[model samples]
Target: MALCPISLSLPTLQYFYSEMRGVDQENEVNRILGAFKLNPYEQLGLRFDCDASALRRQYRRSSLMVHPDKCPHPRAKDAFEILGAALKHLEDPERKSNLDNALSFAKEELLKDWRKATKHDAGVRLAASLDARGMEGVEAAHVATPAFAEAWKARSREVLGRAEWRRRRMSKRIKEEEERGREEHRLEKQLNKNIVEHEKAWEKGRTERVGTWRDFVAKKAKKSKGGPVGGIKPPKRLRALLRCYQQLSKARLSLLVTATASAGYVAGSREQIDWVGLGWTTLGTFMAASCANTLNQVYEISNDALMKRTAARPLPSGRLSRPHALAFAAIAGVGGIWILAGKTNALAAELGAANIALYAGVYTPLKVLSVANTWVGAVVGAVPPLMGWAAAAGSLDLGALILALGVYFWQMPHFMALAWLWRADYAAGGYRMLSLVDPAGLRTARVAFRNSCYLFPLGLAAAWLGVTSPYFAYESGIVTGGLMLCAAKFVSSRSTANARLLLYSSLVYLPCFMLAFLAHRKPNDVDDRLELVMGHLRSLGLFRSGVDREDEGEEREEDQGRVAAGTSGSDGAQSIAPTPGASRPLPPLSPPILTGDFWAGPMVGGLPPRGAKS
Candidate 1:
């Protein structure tokens, strides 16, 4: 769409709107005014002095498309009214400038009111007073402190109320202007009808050339000469700079994932890790994960371009060519494997390579086919910690396997929370996150809570039996697990805001508890290896060496039987409620899109449109 030749002149436009919405369209002056509204003074070909009937016909056609009823919105009630008013103002030369002046003046008055109203904010006032002495331990003067505080509080309310009132007043004024615009539009409709009839009459009589010198000049001015033969233009140096920036961003993401994964490796090995080997394993895992992320992006470029949020990303936006992305992927992938093989044990390097291949080559595509992709993604996500442990321990042992399981189990809740926040984006991009499909959020919340619940005993057992640390297990069980349980309880609220709070809680809980375990040390606490292994097994819910798969299955049934038997005939036995927020799943932060007010949910309003929109 070419921008109108006329200046934006919102103030003038505001004036025109007030005069447009009349029901009458037969007046000559009204038809001319409608033409002016349709084509402003700066338009190259359109003339204000045209015969009225021809212009009237043209505007009537346009009104159909611009009518409020045709283009629906939440606030369609006043759309046509505003358009009519603009037409009305333009139809009359006398009041066009008057309309502009009133609008300009009204805007200024409202802004002034707004400024005065927001001059005192409670948070700011409280902060100032507290900071004057000290917020940490406020020790301000005690001279009539209560009275002063009370006065301040009252004044703050007054100011805040004034601000709110001013905002409402501004909205009302805007609505009023729309009404005036409707009357103007009605007037313009008349002028248009007259201009169009005049044009028809002229055309009826003409059997020969009828081009005016003005028409010829207007036609010449509209043409733009162009020369093109489909030759491609190379990206400018600045474009190249932007490409580098995107690569760096991807690199930065890789570095962080690697570093965090490395931390786990180091932390995992404190019990039985070889320090030198662990360092090598960290080197390999970091490179491998980074390589995989690059590959995943390269593969998903087509899908990314279809998502609003992802469309502007490097590969999808054509910032970097496919070959370039491919080359980067290979370099990262090959270099990462090399690092792992050279620095860590062969087993660590091999596992790292396998994970990368599985994630990028297999699971990445699985996202489109199955929601079980979450499980696949988790398995891939869990590989890094094991890579770390293997880097230190040189191979997978029972303890390392248990530790890996913990990571696999932890990912569901963490990613589900993220999926809730980005549900729209996932749905828009056609990425299969559980939260996207479950609008009720019941299944998402249940799975999230259940996964967290199961982790409690496993985490404690990992610490107690010496798979990790006893202190870490107890702390994880009592504190982190309890916090998750509380967050789970809140997931059944009617507002996505509560779900959003739970999502935040979940994100916080994982990292904090993981760090807590890493920070604990329990070396040499027990002398006998046999006794230590036995303790670990018992904590893990294993009775003895004789226990097999069948026995373990039976034990689980018996435990469930106890729980079921105890809860029999009781409605309160259920651990969690359904759809905490009524029907809508969790949202992110605050400010729900459906609600006028701001609150948080898992996936809030900021994500891209649905998957079908390019």
Candidate 2:
């Protein structure tokens, strides 16, 4: 048949054309949202029980693929609009419930049909034929038609298809999540690298500026040398003074001294702590350390000038005169000892004085004479804790000795590695360090390893002495084992790399050990004794109970007045108040006197008698 061309421009034809386009668009929307082709579960790429967050995540991911801006396909805009509408439909309670009910009804219908088909006469005949294996009977009864065969086949396909679909969905989701995590990790690493580079650049610029300034000042000093003033005219008076103080005090080392002192105070104080006394002890230790350091600089001025490491020190650099250094040392030394003796105790003061003498008098001179100076320096390092202990306890005890020994053992590995690192400097300065004298480094490595081994027992000793809990022993053991491993490595290789490793380990080990010790510090024998005495006093009405103080305040005043009157007499014995009309007089009472120093004195099962010496 011959066909005529239809004009789409006509009103009736245009209307028909628009209607066709609308129908086509509706079909595309249905295909994209899977309204008829897929279940709600498959549409959202999730199981029925998926949570809201998972639903949102999957919906957003699908939307991204269909987004008009990203896809720019003719179908994508329709797909995305339809996906948004479907998400809204699923999100609504009534619409979602209706969809779920319809799905469930369909499944029930399928299952009912499957169940009914199994019970039909045709199924019975089929089963009988298959069982008998009679080809003639099977062919007559339609042997290919088994019981619920189509339903079972359809159900199997559904089961396998659902599982495969979910498997693919989950595998793809996992891969995408992992990729996201890796990208985030890469970005984080890049950010950290940028920060580190910034810090490095800042440090480099600062170091260059400092070097340039130093060179400028040095050149100026050299130019001034030929003038009336000497070659090393000091900088501005205040600047020179500050530099001298920093060099003379050896401020970097003072931190270690202070930390050890604080640790010792914590270990030694059993009953109670006197914060004021601890402050005094720390200040005294720092002052004494500063004084000793000043004396050491004075003694090694020439040697220091020879070594690159020590060339910029106060005396060697001529920033301060010898007389000024001596004056600072004398003042600091005397002031430190006085603070200890007056504020703390005689023993602490004695230890501080001894440390100063040992470090300057013995360690300093012996550095030139013998390699044994390192041992003396270790002794000096050990005494600060003893000073702290004596400051708090007013006596040296087993715990104090153990702490001192720990410090002593710790310094051997610490200094041996340091000596190895700086052996050339020591040789240039004519100082006889073990690393410089023992050319093979065998003895130095052995000593370091041996001392590290000693720390194992040292940590255990703190626990055994009841200064710390048993956990400290385990913690300290692990850290000490690490140090020992480093020491052994240095011994085997005798290389600078191994030596640096040992140095780093020792530095890490000391603070960790100190922290463990502090964490595990327990109440010791003194605390028990003090508690006992306080309980006895409370029972005897000599001390007030802490509870119900508002009610007992008047009674406490009356008791204090009575005790005061009883002690007013010249004789040591005072009469106790007797009951009214009692025939027998109360026995004479000898009450003990309470003083500020009483708690620090010896315990006697109770408070000591009045007038008894501590």
Candidate 3:
């Protein structure tokens, strides 16, 4: 008690103070790690309604106490980061406002419960308690009684629990929505990828598909020879005949030619169709087409051997000798010409001969020399229809010309698609096709699209020329429009898939277009049929015969007056009076007969039966 004080050096004092600071930091780190992490105010040990400056001051003091450089705690970095995050959250205006509102709501609910329990407002009690204690802080625990402090803590816990649940639910819902959007986007991308892969695979397997088709054809030919027929082996003679048949003709193409020839015959005839004559016409057309095809094979044998698609042909495969093929062509040509001349007419025979020569001589030779062979081939396809028209009507007319033009225009798109599809084969065969010359397929697709456009007008022309009804125009328009759309797709993207689509559409378009023409063909004997029906109706007393006779007499008088007036003209040409039983011309069939409002007889002023009431 009586000893003198000993002073320490300045560095020792500084070191002692550093040791105390380090201990305080370690303790602060432990407290920060132990605090509740969800609530910023709880994590920072601050009241809800603290001002921004006080929040910053408290955050800095807490951060220094838990600084990782000074603290010796294992979780010092984690604690420091947590403390910094808490400070940031409290500084946010929206976050601070929400916290303040939550705390006030919790205090209000506590006061209500207190009033119900003690029969007095907790606010008044809290104020009186605070005045008595003389507390300067805004914290409820600093001024409130112990009972109020416990109630406030319970209410705050309940409010914080509900708020945490709502926040988690909102976060989960947002994640679910985001996951659903990603799944939909992934599915759409996968679908697009699959489509592209399918198209690529289809194009890549084109040669394999062609080979398979050729194999199938060869197998069918073998079956026809001696393999099996309906599970029974064919006789040797029958097999020999089948082999000769295969060697002599391309069956599908010949049948198509015959069918087109028959269509032309049907379209041209204004009188009753001669079924016997049609049979002869089909036979002659088939022979003529076979002759052309056989001769073409004979000339292209070497080239055909070089190509995949044509290598399996009889001439190229050596299934038929050149001399035998030449002899077959000769026989077919002579036989076809003779039959046409004997059964039909000179014009039909002449057309048959010309087509054979054009196809075998012009088109076949031009195939290797120039791309104009396609046009020549189209002309060759066009001749059969003319031959049929000649066989039926014994002459060519506008209707015949229209039918031939249809065949001509149709061949362009049909052959262009086929040529583009087999461009590699054509190039290997040394044929100078449009597709071969235009490797990018630009001109080939352009040619196809342009020809498709021509088909629309050709349909309208048929209707305009009175060869078919207006219904045919509408029907053909739809069919050709579809073809045009396919061709346009090929033009835009020269893919094998699109080219194949155009080819299929062309195949369907031809048959449909021909059938529409036949279905809507304007009957030449409509007036005759109408007169015969009217005469029968008069015989049955449905119309008065005396009235019809009177009308005919008046018409004769008017005709005679016109003839007399004509004889008095400066040209002095006398007009003949109409015959007594001659039928009046029928009007064009514009509207469909299936409609309720259609009246065929009234269209040509033939209704009311001359004297019947309207």
- Candidate 1, residues 158-267, lDDT tens digits: the string is 44456557879999989867865774465346435544654575477454334554565565555433422222223555577556545623666555456556655765
- Please, what are the lDDT tens digits per residue for candidate 2 over residues 134-214? 544533344235443344334444654565588799999899778767754654465456446545765777777779879
TM-scores of all candidate predictions against the true structure: 0.46, 0.49, 0.49
lDDT of 1 at 208: 36
Leading candidate by lDDT: 3
Task: Rank candidates, lDDT, best first.
Answer: 3, 2, 1
Model 1 CA deviation exceeding 4 Å by range: 1-256, 268-279, 523-531, 535-614
Per-residue lDDT for 1-614 in model 3, tens only?
33423343566788999998878887787777876666677677666556778778888898877777867778889998998888887778898778778878998887666546644657656665677443333244432666665555567778988999999999998997787677546544654564465457657877887898798777777667544753344587478756766656787898899999999888877757888999999999999998998898999877776677877777766556799899988998899999999999999999999899899889999998899999999999999999998998888866788888888999999999999998766766777788865757889999999999988887787776677877998999999999999999999999999999999999999999889988887653444434444454444445434434446457667898988887778876766667655775333322233333322232133334433333
TM-score of 1: 0.46
Off by over 4 Å in 2: 1-239, 527-614
Give the Cα-based TM-score of candidate 3 against the true structure: 0.49
Global lDDT scores for all candidate models: 0.58, 0.74, 0.78
lDDT of 3: 0.78
